[model samples]
Every structure is written in structure tokens, then in C-alpha cells.
Target: MLANPALQAFSMFLVGTALTLGDVHSHVWARACWCLTDVLFLMAFVQWLRWPGSYGRKLESIWYLRWGGRVSLRKAAEIVYSEARAQESVWAHAAERMSLDKSPDGILCYIAEVIKQDTTIYGKRPPSTHVEKLDPLQLKYGTVTNGAREVRMRDNAKTVFTDLQVDAKELRRALHEVRESLRTTMPI
Candidate 1:
């Protein structure tokens, strides 16, 4: 976080300008340095929230903001999607899907205990990722957080998250499906 040169320079410059813009002699030079440090720390924490962090961290942050009661579910998903697109490695790739026992959002997923809620998704039970091939399950139901605010993008009409979900029922079924269809494979 401290390695961001642009952020460091900007925070320093802003603090310096503010101090100098007023009566310079009113504040000690050493005090100004401390002020700059404080500003830098504050900016760093605030800016850190914008970074596309590790998958779980990023998911939790977005989920936190989304369910923070500040915006609607669709609006939250849209906000996260837009911010993710601006980052280098985008949030959730739309092309591929993985099927196994459970989604990455398992029992202990939420960042804060306070955020653990049964309102939208059950946090206590390990969610079932399995489903019939009729339609893609909402990622939220599976405790995942990439697709829509609902987890697996349930209503593509609501959010832009488009993570594909293939129903890999069993090993033999998966093998047969793989041979039958040439699907793009993604890393686990």
C-alpha cells in the first residue's frame, strides 16, 4: 500500500499545499511532516478499499459495500462491476464455470461476524452448489460473491456479473460432458 508512488506523492502534495496555503509559520516544519504522514496513512486506507484484492478479500469488500445499506442490490453489483473493470485483472471472468463439491464461499466466508446474515444467504450452513441443468443458480445462494450481489448471477437482467455455471454432477458425467463439448478450461 505504501508502495503506490502516485498515492504517496498526491497525499504529500495535498497536505503540503494545505499547510503552506495557510500561515506557514503558524505550524512547525516538523509538525507539517507528521501531518503529511497522517494524511498519507488516511489516504492509503481509503484508497486500499479500491484495490482489486485477493479473490476472497475483494468479494468480501464488495459484499460489505453492497450490503452496507447504501445502495440497492443491482446498484451494488453495477458499482462493483464497474470498479472491477477499471482494474487490470477484472473481477469475475464470464466465460468459464467450475463444478465440484462447494463454492469458495464456504462456512467462514464473511469478513465480519456482524455481516454474517441469513437475510440473503445462509452463512451457517455449507451451501449446495449442485443444481439441475435448467438454469444457473444464483451465486449468492452458494455463498459465492462474484456473479451478482445475489452470489451466482441469478438475474442477468439485474446485474452484469456473468460467471458461467456448468452442472458437473459427477466424475463420469463431467467426463462425458467434457468429451461432448469443447469448453474453455479455467484454473482451479
Candidate 2:
């Protein structure tokens, strides 16, 4: 599209003429519509050129981060494990020994597993842990959706921290283990 100088000049001329004439009720409306149609068509074409499942995969990663931020690594893991246990998955066995207030690391480990499984199937980065460094995925997806209230993780720190067992050492180790395991097990 950018390589077509005549098309670019024509679009610019149409736009400038339309603006100077300010004739919304005249042929300018048709020009405007055509311009919009062209832009949309180009955008659709570009979107179609993208890899299959990439958009949905990106959306899932983003949702995971936003939701993950609402809870600590510990609590997020527990929520995942709790859901898994309720479904009676074998992964739930990992969480059987720990109480909600006692196993932040276990939760982190479980969260890692949950994310690994997801990314394996979906083909995008997974939810990150508290100890994990921020990735391009997080940076891309962490922005608040339009008109949506921004959730501040720090403002909810008390609840998040409380939900977590808050053992720094254990949480650290859990994060490291999960990161390592995911690196090895997650499909590219």
C-alpha cells in the first residue's frame, strides 16, 4: 500500500480537497467512505496475513496477566490448583498438602504448570510469576482495556499478600523452579 505513490497522492488530494471544501453533504461523503473502506480493507488483509491462532493466543496471554496481577503468585497458583482439584486433575495432588495460608510456593508451582499447559496448546507466552522478570508479552498485554477501571495490584496488596503465605524464600524458590520447568517443558 505504501509503495503506491499515485494512490497515496490521490488519497491526500481527496482528503485535502474534502477538508477545504467541508462538503460533508456532497461527494466528499463518498470520498470519505471510500477512504475508510480502503483503510479497513487493508487492515483486514494484514490481519489475515498473520499466523493462525496468534490473535487468540495473544488475547489469552493478556487476560492471564491482567487476572494474574489481581492475585499474588501464591494466590494465583492456589486458584489454579483449586480449580484443578475441583476437576480432580492429577496436578491437584501437588496442592493437597498445603493450606491456603501456608503454601504460596506450591501455588506458584501450580500456576506455572497451568500456564505451561495453556501456552503449549495456544502458542503464546504464559502467565508470569512474581519472581519472573517482565516479558514482552506482559508489557504488551498489561495495559487496561478501554474504559475499564484499572486494577492496582499494590492497592490490593493486603488481600493478595494475605492470600499468599508470604514466605519470601519459598516463593523465590518456587518461582525459580517453575520458570526452569516451564523453560524445559513448554513447547516453543
Candidate 3:
């Protein structure tokens, strides 16, 4: 119907927004309608448009940076962790123990997960964590939506981190073993 100007005009007439050529009107003549889809398409075809870069593209591109490599991921995670820890709140401490994943996917997931927790008691259930695969094409060209507003993952294996338990006795044993090994191998 949109392809047929007559049909479109008739529809517009039914909607009372049609203004045809050679049509004479009274003192007041004003009509408006939404008929620009084709015009928009034509304009889109006529222009050389640049698509947007994804939020993760830059991070991913520098993933294999010859100088720092994966150190970048770890460092970014450490900064995120430190900032949260510096909040000095119970939630901050708990987030500290989250054992955040130290990779590109991990950092994104961590940020998205962290900001999802609202500081309100509105009785609204927090949105559950969701595992969503990122499309390679979309990740290459399209922008990521709300990466820090909700907890989203590419897959179960893409989880930002896991809740871990600390065992005091096990920690002490590991430290003692490390100390003994270092003393015996002393280059110091």
C-alpha cells in the first residue's frame, strides 16, 4: 500500500492528513502525516554512512597488544576491584570476595553485574543474571547496550566470577609451604 501513492493518499485521506497536488483548500489548510520511511531509505542509500564501533571492540583490539597483553585485563580488574573495595561498605567487601574474572568478558560481566544491584528497597526483584551470546558481527560494528546496567554473560563459562570460600587452615599451610620453598631456593 505504501508503494502505491494512490493507496497511500487514500489512506492518508481516511486519516485526514492528505494534501494532494492541485487541491484547493480554504483559509486554514494544515495536514501532517508520517510518510517519510521511503524518503529515509532513499537518503540512507544515497549517503556514505559510517557505522558505530562496539564498546568492546577497542578492548578486544588491544587484547593482543604486544607490550602488556593479558596484563591489561588483570590490571583493569584490579582497578575495578579496588574502586569497589574503597567504598568501605559491606557490599564493597562482599564484592571484593567475588573473585572477579580477569579477562575481557570477565570485566564486562563484572561491571554489568556490579551496577545491577540497586540501593533501594522498592521490593522489586532484581533482574536475574542472564547469559547472552554476543554476536561477532554486532560486537564488531554495533554498540553494546546497557553493559553496566544489568548482569549479562555470553555463556555460563563467561561468568565474571564465582563466590569462593576462604579456609584459614588451608591458607596457612600454603603459605608455610611457599616460605619453606623460598628459603631452600634462596637467591636472596
Candidate 4:
């Protein structure tokens, strides 16, 4: 972000020189200016770090990447498990044991849809329409971006996302167990 290395170096040099000069008039103003410069640099640095294109964005991407793979793994596991479960209850649907009431692929597809929606909302893909625009108010601000908002909204959003993550993992784990049990006859 700081493309002007010369300026940054000069400022650092000035600050250092000011620190060592130890003069009343010149040093005072120089140190004051240096302090001001440092504050400005710090703020800019903070902003850059928080920018959507910076490490902040990268971190978010990484999280989603990990979560996405986990979600996929969960989907894979679900497929395997569901097959095994289906085999056990081939005569009668095991709707009771698998009380989830939703197919693994169905949930994965739904989650995938949500991910697509999130990406579109967050501008991951090209915006399709104005109504599809993301509301900044929806972001999990405290964990990701610091914003002024009532506790309820943040808490609610965090809870929803957390639930989604947990459900995805649990479903995936079940599928993984199923896959492990029937490894030899795995469909795909």
C-alpha cells in the first residue's frame, strides 16, 4: 500500500533525527510532526489491512475455502452414509433413523446455493441485479469488520452462520462414517 518508500524512509529518518536532535524548538515541532506522521501511517496501515482487497479479504477467502471444502467433504460423507443407511432400510425408508429429513445432496445443494448467494451478495461474482446487492448491515461485523450496530443483529448473524457451519460439519461427518463403513462398494 505504501508505494512511496522514499517518503516513508524520509519520514522515518526525520523521526529518528528528531528523536536524537534533542533541541527545544526544532525537535519539539519535528517530533510533533513525526508523531502525527506516525499516527497517519498507522491509520492508513490499519485501513489497508482492513480493506476488502487486502489480507482481510484473503483471510475471509481462506475461511470460506476451508469451509467450502469441509462442506464438500460433508456432502461426500453424506452421500456415502446415505447409501449405507439406504441399504439397511432398503425395504422401508429409514426416515426415523435419519431424522434429518433431507437428502445429503439436497442440503449440500442448498448450502451451495447459499454460498452462491453469499458470493453474489459479497461481489464474488458479477452482480446480476440491483436487488441482489449486499446490505452492509448483514456482515458479521465484529468478527470481520468493525461496525456500529446493535448487539442483536451481530449476535443473530453470528448464530446463523455458526449453525450453518455446525450442521454442515455434522452432516459431513455422518456421511464420512457411512463412506468408511462401505468403502468397498462406494458408488463413485
By lDDT, the candidates rank as: 2, 4, 1, 3
Better of 1 and 4 by TM-score: 1
- Which of 1 and 2 is the better model by TM-score? 1
Give the C-alpha miss distance for residue 101 in model 3, angstroms. Answer: 4.3
> Predictions ranked by TM-score, top down?
1, 2, 4, 3
lDDT of all predictions: 0.38, 0.40, 0.33, 0.39
In the range 51-107, model 2's lDDT, one tens digit per residue, is 234566545433544443333433435434443543444445544444242344534
- Score residue 117 of candidate 4 by CA lDDT: 28
Q: TM-score for all predictions?
A: 0.26, 0.23, 0.20, 0.22
- Per-residue lDDT of model 4, residues 1-188, tens digit only: 36554457457767757665766455666666676667667765664454234465446444543465333322322333334544442211333233333554444333333232223222221223222223445533422111101111356434212212223444444434443543333364
Candidates 2 and 4: which is better by lDDT? 2
> What is residue 147's positional error in candidate 3, in angstroms?
12
Give per-residue CA lDDT, model 3, range 137-187, as digits (tens).
323332212322222235544333212111223223322332333221235
Candidate 4: clashing residue pairs, number: 4
Pairs of residues at least 3 apart in sequence or in different chains that clash in candidate 1: 138-152, 139-151, 139-152, 140-150, 140-151, 140-152
Worst 10 residues of 3 by lDDT: 116-125
Query: lDDT tens digits, residues 1-188, model 1?
Result: 56874568576767666776775875676466556767777776667666655667666645545344333233333333334233312132221122222343321122111121212322111144432222223433333343223333335454322222221122123223323433235343
RMSD of each: 15.5, 16.3, 22.8, 19.7
On lDDT, who's better, 3 or 4? 4
